[model samples]
Target: MTVQLNNGFLKQQTGNTIQIDQPVKLLVVNLMPNKLETERQFVRLFSHLSLDVAVTFLRMASHHSKHIPEAKLQQTYATLTDVYDQQFDGMVVTGAPVEDIAYDAVDYWPEFNTLLNWRHDHVRQSILECWAAQAGIYVDFGINKRVIPKKLFGVYRCEIDQKTALTAGFNQLSMPQSRHATLGHINDPRLAVLASDPEAGPVILASKQTHSTYISGHPEYETNTLFNEFNRDREKGLPIQLPKNYFSKDKPTNTWQRDSIHLYDNWVHSLKKVKV
Candidate 1:
């Protein structure tokens, strides 16, 4: 259950050995256009933890990806039908680029609904990120996301509920947020607000029944994610503002998000404790 690492090559952690068990099977439903980059981001965060997690990427069978090559998708990803009878300890639904559109308008909305319903029986714990968070809330609780005046594209300071297992070690957390829509008001009794920000509203929401976690911000985002998004928008002549608290001296540099890593570590621990 434990393994040692020396200081020579593995520079991320110092000390001797780390404890690990049988690798946790995680199903990742990637909705992002840039599938490979998103997968790498999640894998990078998951690798930092002591637990070994085997991730299986799931692509939408209903929606065809225009950005990623068809051959690559066929080779690397699995459809819902491929793993319909299988179950996982944890499932992650990534944020998509379809935030501007209505939930019913998206091509994969129906398929998404099917997947959400399936998770009730197939998954032990699920984490929905950004647009998928909105979708999950709307599908399960009938809470619709509202359009914001400006895109919430920046690194925000969030107040975490330290008492929650998902955020046990985090007091205040900084995460990357990039979305055009916001979960305006959630009045569901089954949902608990785990974290929030004045600018970003509800950063984290947890469901009492399904043990599902929803995150409006991208904790798995790399340091330059927001900076790259800002530049991309600017190049396209889109009205974009500088990501707050991201670049020091207004210059893009690698921002070490140690707290984000801890947040994920806590989440993986919580998943491991689940009785399934």
Candidate 2:
């Protein structure tokens, strides 16, 4: 997963060379069921950047994971107390599988709220993905999520709304999305919609005041991520559909990786400008 930043399309924007005197402290609060797989996915994306990033994985103290073994969690992950006093250059809150339930009803909702508040003060830039995106908008702005009749599961074409650094190298972007809930009508003037799709609604939102970015789709998903998910659900006899625009001749492919890496690269580039 070595990404040549000097390449034509993926070339980094012209700017001062990012001073790598110290590795950027990146914290990923992973709420996905498969911790190790999620970690590898994110690390693969981060590894593409030219910057030296020291990534720290965080787990919730209140909600015990059913999928990952407790010993693995104990051996590899950190709780909030471990990094409570530390500030990070960037942080990522991954989407959890508990989208159907109310935010308050989740077991670790209270603890998550505490973490979000702490991030507001400590982190320079934070990305909230999927469920975390909905939660962030609800916490920051009074926007609520509405349940769509069917799961919005597929790779949808998104139109970039603004020419911010986050969306610097993109025109029309294709992103992978899997979620049961979509954000309701947003009325907050403080929040800016960055990218959107006709079916997926608001796919990206950014808040200048908080320095927070919310992404409704999983741009970090691997090439076969949606395929694996679809199979997993189908095997369990759950209702599932073929991921749109993801397969070529009804077969899975890795077309979205280039754009995904480009988006993440832009994010890392933005972190370099932060005087944290």
Residue pairs with backbone overlap in model 1: 1-20
Give the poorly placed runs of model 2, Cα more than 4 Å off: 1-21
Q: Rate the local accuracy (lDDT) of all candidates.
A: 0.81, 0.83
Q: Distance from true position, residue 216, model 1, in Å?
A: 0.2
Over the stretch 1-276, how does candidate 2's per-residue lDDT look in tens digits?
232221111122232233334676788898988876787788778877766676778889888877766776665678899889998888999999999999999999999999989998889999999999999888888789999888899898899988899999899888899999998666688999989998899998999977899999998899889999999999999888888888888788877778888888788778878854
- Per-model TM-score, in order, reads 0.90, 0.90
Compose the digit string of candidate 1's lDDT tens values, residues 1-276. Answer: 222221111223243345335667788898988876786687678778767776677889888878867766776678899999998888999999998888889999999999999999999899999999988998888888999989887888888753688878777888889989998766778998888898899999998797799999898898788888988999999999988777777676445368777877787788788845
- What's the CA error at residue 162 for candidate 2, in Å? 1.2
Q: In candidate 1, what residue range of length 10 has the lowest lDDT sum?
A: 2-11
The numbered model that scores best in lDDT is: 2
**Model 1 steric clash total:** 1
Tell me how many clashing residue pairs each candidate has. Answer: 1, 0
